[model samples]
Target chain A: MISTASAVIGSRVSVGHRMLALTWLISPLLLLATWALVAASGHYSAQLLIPPADVWHTFKDLLHSGELLEGAAFSLRRLASGFVLGASGGLLFGAALALSKTVEVYCAPMFHVLRQVPSIALIPMFILVFGVEETFKVLLVTKAVFFPVALATSEGIKAIPRSHFEVARLYRLPRYSLLLDVVFPAAAPPILTGLRVGLTRAWMVLVAAELLAADSGLGQMIEMGRQMMRIDVVMVGVITIGLIGFVLDSSLRLLERRLFRWKAIKE
Target chain B: MNASLDQRWLASTSHSPGALQIRELSKHYLLDGQPMEVLKGIDLRVKPGEFVSIVGASGCGKSSLLRLIAGLESDYSGDMQLDGKAITTTSLERGIVFQDHRLFPWKTVAQNIAIALKRSPLTRQEKALRVAEHIRLVNLQGFENAYPHQLSGGMAQRAAIARALITQPKLLLLDEPFGALDALTRISMQRELQRIWVQHRSTMIMVTHDVEEALYLGDRVIVMDARPGRIKYEIDVDLPHPRERHAPRLQELKEILLTELAGSDADK
Candidate 1:
């Protein structure tokens, strides 16, 4: 009975420890409460700053009518398809550049210049080439996702210690086996970080594309609400986009943890 | 089959006058169109099963010679024959342990050892058993799942030893594997290496700047002078494996190495 009590106390201590570790989570809640207070005070006009209660009501109405759900699903699908293709292509291309001196020498300068041009800056060119269609949105996401992943992969591969390469040679690890077993694992953590950054950037770009031209998606829904002067609906759309982005970043972080358990074991 | 291979390894080292025969080995480094000769017509031989330690001042090409034998550097002129086979690129038949543990941070202890076995034709069960056996040989049981970071410097090095031995190589080359360790740990690891070497009986060649370390573990100590390194002198330690640190023969060799290194420094 005494041991059980001690176990209960131990669990409580661990819970307290977790709460302390996650102290940053309180800031967003505080910001939300402050926004509600500012809206209630009517310091800004209602059109510019809708009360949280009204936003909540509009959010519920949109949820009931399934408009928000449909819009979110559409945006998510476009994000996934474009980001996957872009990130995978970037990974392979980056590995090639890092592994081969000739490839790096020939391609590096052009890639460097191209990466500086922001994805949003290319929207007009994309529109001119592909027109204002599904292709344009996907291409925008692809552009956003590609550079970070490529840069991360190249840098990560280069950062691997020379000693490790010597070890690989000493083992006479076959070409494919060396890549699969040593090179990829050594490169994964940074590549995963790049993927997370690329994904979030692509998500933001997709929303911008939808805002500019798309017929459906949360960003377009917000544009429609703005045109109709339904500020509450626009507010709901903004909140949902932010929340979804947060969830995506968190989940990618979880996967990184799983893949890099060996790092933690060493620590 | 295993017994026969071990027997052959023993016989080859015993019957042959030299375990390693290097004749007219030369290496030149080119910098900005200037050719600098690092090793100039070096001729050396290590007798079978002899624990030879090579010592030299920094930039004396001691490490470069070891690298040539380890098959890390192929751009050299000469013949380096081990047990009558010309040394080329790395082979499973030869093993090396470096100063750093060099264990992959992503792999567990068992996984790291298993990587060395991947190219071998051994069955999966046999590989697992051999890996476990080597781990025990290095006294690292119950650490099968531990990552490299989880181990202390000494333990990680021991794991590295196990990985090298897993291939059952004919020759073991150590390039200052304990240099990065603390003084206390270095002594203990030296003792551990002595014990392990006694048990395995492989032809071991270790390189170190520490004269005492070279004297304590080596059967024959070869001292090299500084500029464009070459063998200056050799002292034979007739003491057996797991030899006492305070043994009269070891003490004599230790004093000789100290005076040689000190005399070389004074000459410079």
Candidate 2:
């Protein structure tokens, strides 16, 4: 009984230790501490650098007013639609480039050159062609997502060993079975990584697009706050953007782990 | 009279199914803008349920020969036939296990085996049963749910064997199936493979560098010379299944093979 009690205590202590070791949760707390200390030191004017408490109050006010939530929801919808379009196109195009030598020969060189142009750089041209509307912002996010995903997908397909194809041939697997069972799974780790990278890039580009021209979104909120001299509100928007990007990336990483659990065992 | 009848029955049965006949088999590849011959003027005939081992040094095109037989490489001047049908492309009737187990790392042992049954007309339940049966044949009953990465090298190769055999191919080709294993594991796996072959009695052709392995498992060991690879000689083991490893005949054949290999290296 005494040993069992000690074992329970030991288990509780380890659980607490694990919580402490979660640096992602702890990092923001550390940043908050530093901000509070700097605010108390009075090194700068309050107008120049708002305290964490003031930022918190601004965040609560935005929440209660529902503008922040509405902006976030609208931003997420655009991101989802753009990401889906861009990623699907990327997947098909990438698989084509990998599978067909003729397609690769014609398009690969041009693709390499075109993908070098940043989405932000193309924003002006997109605005001219698409107008400064939802199309422009959505296209910007799509452009951001397409290049990375395509490159990753193509590389992943290329990296598959010839032996895999031989095995498929030996088994005489149907074309659909080859694609679903062999090609997809063999190339998935890199493709999933590509999706994660594309997601974060999409989020970043969407924010940048909103900042430049959007009538709504967290980025627009930040811009409006800046114009109104509400630094605390801008800070809240910035923090929210970072948090959302972090959440998106972490969830993708979680999914990757779950799907490619075999990789972890091999390592 | 009964023994004679049994002998005739066995001969007819062995000659009837899975007979691979290769004639004037030659393969060429372009190297540095020059055509290089890999396999030259080869002729081999493998009877049904016979285990033929081909041994050669590296670069001897032993692997290429296996690939040609497996129909992975078709650019060859050869008349290759299986059970009187021309072998032009990969077929479910021919199964191959590479030097590496080549078990799809993403799949569990059972899934890897089941994937080979995709083209089979067997029902789902029958396929599952066959997969389980083959898994048991390879002594991997408890590892059905385990992924390839989770298995040891020997176990993974066994799983590959199971996968290859699950289709119940008329002929099975193994390209150095135990080449990647440790010495002890290789010995044990060779024994397991012999046992499996005894049980299945399907035509199997294995390519390996190990002379003892070739002699121990093969009904006939074909020794090939490098540089325009061709059969230099063939040694008939004339031994039965579960043969003693230290048999004088095997030891003598191993010495002859080693000398032949070393002599060719000297000639080079």
What are the clashing pairs of model 1?
none
**Most accurate candidate by DockQ:** 1
Best by TM-score: 2
In candidate 2, what are the lDDT values of residues B1-268, reduced to their tens digit?
4897555433422212399999999999999999999999999999999999999888889999999989999889979999989989998788899889988889999999899989878799878877776787788989999988789999999999888877677898999999999999999999998987886688999999889999999999998988899999888899888789999989988998888888878878
The digit string of per-residue lDDT tens for model 1 on A66-126 reads: 9999999999989988998889888988898899999899999998999899898898899
Question: Alpha-carbon error at B217 in model 2, in Å?
Answer: 1.6
Candidate 2 Cα outliers beyond 4 Å, as residue runs: A1-30, A40-43, A264-267, B1-16
lDDT of 1 at A222: 93
Clashing pairs in 2: none
* lDDT (Cα atoms) of all candidates against the true structure: 0.86, 0.88
DockQ of each: 0.70, 0.69
Q: Against the hidden true structure, what lDDT does model 1 obtain?
A: 0.86
What is the number of backbone collisions in each predicted candidate, taken in the order shown? 0, 0
